[model samples]
Target: MQIMSNENAHSETDLRAEGVRVTRQRLAILHVLREASDHPRAEDILTRARLQDPSVSQATVYRTLAMLEKAGTVLRNEFDGAGARYELADRHHHDHLIDLDTGVVVEFQSPRIEQLQAEIAAELGYEIEWHRLELYGRKAT
Candidate 1:
């Protein structure tokens, strides 16, 4: 299963805050990402963008996504060797549980995991700056 936050979904305002210029193609791409619940690949964004504006092209989606990711408004993840998937970066911090067979990404947060990471980091003489955790498995039958 995939969980996504629709609240404060990426908007033109976010782009402007990052000093990104709002254009038609970029808006189409951002709109697609805004409406998505699951991590979508560049191809998925391109397909969705084209639905709203026939002029949206594959290259534009890729470029726009790259620009957004660089601007810290989008996150890109690749779990279990799957291709890159994108989501809005403004969401609360959470790790991913990826279903290997179906390619589903489930988001979750655990205080215990955070505490463990902090303890481990302290043991190694370093304060945790950031981290990304991914667990891969299939549905239990």
Candidate 2:
């Protein structure tokens, strides 16, 4: 299982392409997300964004996150019924393993699992539009 990378780092131009109003706060938020491997919550984003631009606000973080998710530039995951954690949507398809005890998220890709899902979908006479696989577990005792 490989952790995600900055392969899809976004910029102000991305927001413009998404037809969003580009601002310093938004750019700082984007920078924070681009540098994050661990999917972060809005509060974490706001805190990091403020480090990049002191003018960033909590409302702006939430609003920008909503805009990015709506624009399909970011993805919101509610693992273990937890508050939304976010990651860039452009990364290669992968599944997650959440540490139930520590609330850590690990990203991994598996072709065998992908093939099995496709096979199952075919058996069900349905096509998969999209899917999310999350496994919650703890370290071996």
Candidate 3:
């Protein structure tokens, strides 16, 4: 079994400070999110976490994911009209492009698009705090 070092223990401290109760399942879910390169659906997370903690129930995982999303510790985006995919939000929010053919998601950050959005919102005399941009397309054959 791996030991939790002082530094690793501090992450739990930080998470609790963010209003999340520290639990084995919550920590497991957080670990999965941190290690996931591709945002995963709730089912994906549940399946992966169950391998780590067999006692982890689907309902617990789903509830934990919802709490994490509400705390802004994770972000959720829907792709191809399917369920929402989740990713850990550290810094720098970006957009997603989902390949409808292969079911792959590509993340991209564009300053030009960000500037255009700000300008357009300003033109409409509205202030934008957050936004979600998801582009869906199929791969070329």
Candidate 4:
């Protein structure tokens, strides 16, 4: 395995902090996730990881992803009928806008929508704990 850079080394530290073992396969998968610009599926991750370490297995990648998700270090999104895509959990909250026509995923934040959600929850005499909002629509011509 190639020596991890400072950026990826931090990811190793994060995995350790999450009480996960720092295995070669896990590190390879984590590296792939960190370098990805788009949220990628398990198959995509496995493919990229294999390019780095041929010994990395699909089962290992899947298991590592599940472990990361359980530790709240990764976010898994199942868009429409497509398979799950994974991304690192963001420090700031945001929602997703999926383009039905092109399968594009857009991340956005809206203060007005957030405030409206809070107000609606208050009106129902319930405090908002956690929520997920996903908007799906086709691109305008």
TM-score of each: 0.92, 0.93, 0.86, 0.87
Tens digits of per-residue lDDT for model 4, 9-77: 336777787688899888888888878756788999999999999999989988989999998888899
Candidate 3 C-alpha lDDT tens digits along 12-125: 777788978989988888777776767789999988888888888889988988888898777777776688888876645678778877787877777888889999999999
Local distance difference test, candidate 2: 0.87
Work out candidate 1's RMSD over C-alphas. Answer: 2.2
Model 1 segments more than 4 A misplaced: 1-6
Which pairs in model 4 have colliding backbones?
Answer: none
lDDT of each: 0.84, 0.87, 0.78, 0.81
Error of 4 at 47 (Å): 1.1
Top candidate when judged by TM-score against the true structure: 2
Q: Which stretches of candidate 4 lie over 4 Å from their true place?
A: 1-10
Worst 10 residues of 3 by lDDT: 1-10
* Residue 139 shift from truth in candidate 3, angstroms: 2.4
The clash tally of candidate 2 reads 0
Comparing 1 with 3 on lDDT, the higher-scoring candidate is: 1
Q: Which ten residues in a row are the worst by lDDT in model 1?
A: 1-10
Q: How does model 4 fare in lDDT?
A: 0.81
- Sort the candidates on lDDT, descending order: 2, 1, 4, 3
- For residues 1-141, write the lDDT of model 2, one tens digit per residue: 465444785667766887988888888888888889889999999989998899988999999899889999899999988799998887899899999989889888888888899999999998899999999999999
